[model samples]
Target: MDVMEWTGQVYADTPIVSAETYVEAPPARVWELVSDIHLMPELSSELREVAWLDGLTSPGTGHRFAGRSAHDALGSWETISTIVDCEAPRRFTWAVGDPGHPSSVWSFLLQAQGEGTVLEQWAQMGPGPSGLSLAIEAMPDKEQKIVFVRLREFETGMKANLAAIKGLAERRA
Candidate 1:
């Protein structure tokens, strides 16, 4: 029997779901796709809306944006995220400031892979009340299940986003 010890702590405050995809585009092009955060909604179908609280410029640490995301019945919700780190054509990370949030950070890391770019999506939340706060305080177990469901949904959405970006970049190339 292969016993696996799953001692990793539960991270409710900084829960992260991550996925990666390789796109047949140069790093520079990939940067153009990600660096222009405001254009996210235009480039990716999953991003319902992205309002730059600041102008269109390469985001810096502390830069903020209000965003809404939802592709189906789940409906869209507003979130304010602050860029904690930004490194062009390589890495960008942000943290959400929504009330009763489950995750604290979301990030994108890009790298040159052969004649293409590899894009990685990562999220982090702290350990507290599952990602859901007030409404589900009465039922912790249910909230746990909901968190799992949301993570899975987010994973699927991220794949779609990457595909959309790949399509746009390839078309331009």
Candidate 2:
């Protein structure tokens, strides 16, 4: 995993982090893993649970879902996310909070690589209010540090997610 350069970004900067891995399985198999919202808690350290909303059973553009997440310092919270992009066997993206001004955005991108697939997990922090924003408000002096640390945590989690997906896809292939 390549370290993301987010040294001094503030919350308004909307810092982004991403990690990628090559999976021995094809894009279709990788898509099955990435598109399954319920499987995320199994792979992510922060996410505790997820459920599709409004009777939806699968992912699609404009679909919504609720996710519960927990962090040691931040405790736990729930966010309703909207699917902003959905391209089967290619990409899946969702925005946490309001889609027009999301607190965060996350994505999984798949590209065919030889006989396998290259999968990348990407995330961008707030342009909207979030738990981190509350922390920043409490200690304005540490805004940069807070953002940097959170981005680091996102990077670490994204790497783990990609690794887990790779393992699962290969084993099932």
Candidate 3:
């Protein structure tokens, strides 16, 4: 949203939302923000709360977590997520719902650039069961519209998250 153009990808009918910004902090500084599962609710509006499961103290592949979210239109719900990828100081990714066939895939990619980290937040909705899938099924004729609205919501939220992380990382740095 800052200087990056609007970007998205599609995978088998699922819409992907991705946005990146330059954070005035080193990769390690930025990674501390991105890798902390418990910090999300503090930085997000829709994400009301989160917690790690299985007594995990840090993120790695196969770690599980739960998140609770709310929206004026969507109301409130809780989700189960699994860490699908974790590459320190560079990339982190996770899957919502069933890990084997996730309802959504979300990721953060960090690249060191000119003393700072270019942090990107990404999300892809549904190749399996999801609230979006349920909504689409309920209104098959409005699939495109549904996807558009949902992706827009994600885009806006991700941008806000990036901005907050940038501020925090820069302040701490």
Candidate 4:
């Protein structure tokens, strides 16, 4: 895996990190995995749990979910996320902590590639407050380093997520 480049960005920069893998399965099969919010914790390290909110059972634009995440340095926290975009078998996206001004935005994109699929996981950080913002508040001078480290963590986590999804999708295929 190539390391994602970071240029010491701060919160306002809204930096993005993405990782992708080729899955030996069709987009439909891969979509079943990515669109299921309940399955995410199984593929993620920092995300501990997720559940659909307001009696919702599936993803759709305007639907909401709660996600609990834990990081060693950042501790544990829960955030309500709203689905900003959902296109079956192609894309699924959500905004954490308010759709209007989210702390972060996350997405999964899938494209058919020959007999298989190319799946990408993407994330963008900060136009709002988050655990990272708290850390930055404590040490303003370390904002750039904090953002860089967090972006690296996001990149690593996305790569791992793609790997796990690839394994599962291929096995099912």
Q: Highest lDDT among the candidates is held by which one?
A: 2
Task: At residue 29, give the lDDT of candidate 4.
Answer: 98
CA displacement after TM-score superposition, residue 166 of candidate 4 (Å): 0.4
Candidate 1 local lDDT, 32-100, one digit each (tens):
877677767775555678766867455877788887876554455677777877888788877777433
Residue range 27-81, candidate 2, lDDT tens digits: 9999999999999999989999999999999999999999999999999999999
Q: Which pairs clash inside model 3?
A: none
Better of 1 and 3 by TM-score: 3
**Predicted structure 1, TM vs. truth:** 0.76
- Candidate closer to the true structure by lDDT (higher is better), 2 or 3: 2
- Give stretches of model 1 more than 4 Å off: 1-13, 42-47, 54-56, 69-76, 98-102, 126-131
Candidate 3 error regions (>4 Å) = 2-12
Error (Å) of candidate 2 at residue 113 is: 0.8
Q: Give the Cα lDDT of each candidate.
A: 0.67, 0.94, 0.86, 0.93
TM-scores vs. true structure, each candidate: 0.76, 0.97, 0.91, 0.97
The CA-based lDDT of model 1 is what?
0.67
How well does candidate 2 match the true structure in TM-score terms? 0.97
Candidate 4 lDDT, 1-173, residue by residue in tens: 58977698889999998889999999999999999988899888889999999999988999999999998999999999999999999999999998999999999999999999999999999798999989999999999999999999999999988998899899998
Model 2, which residues run further than 4 Å from truth?
A: none
Cα error, residue 46 of model 3, in Å, equals: 1.6
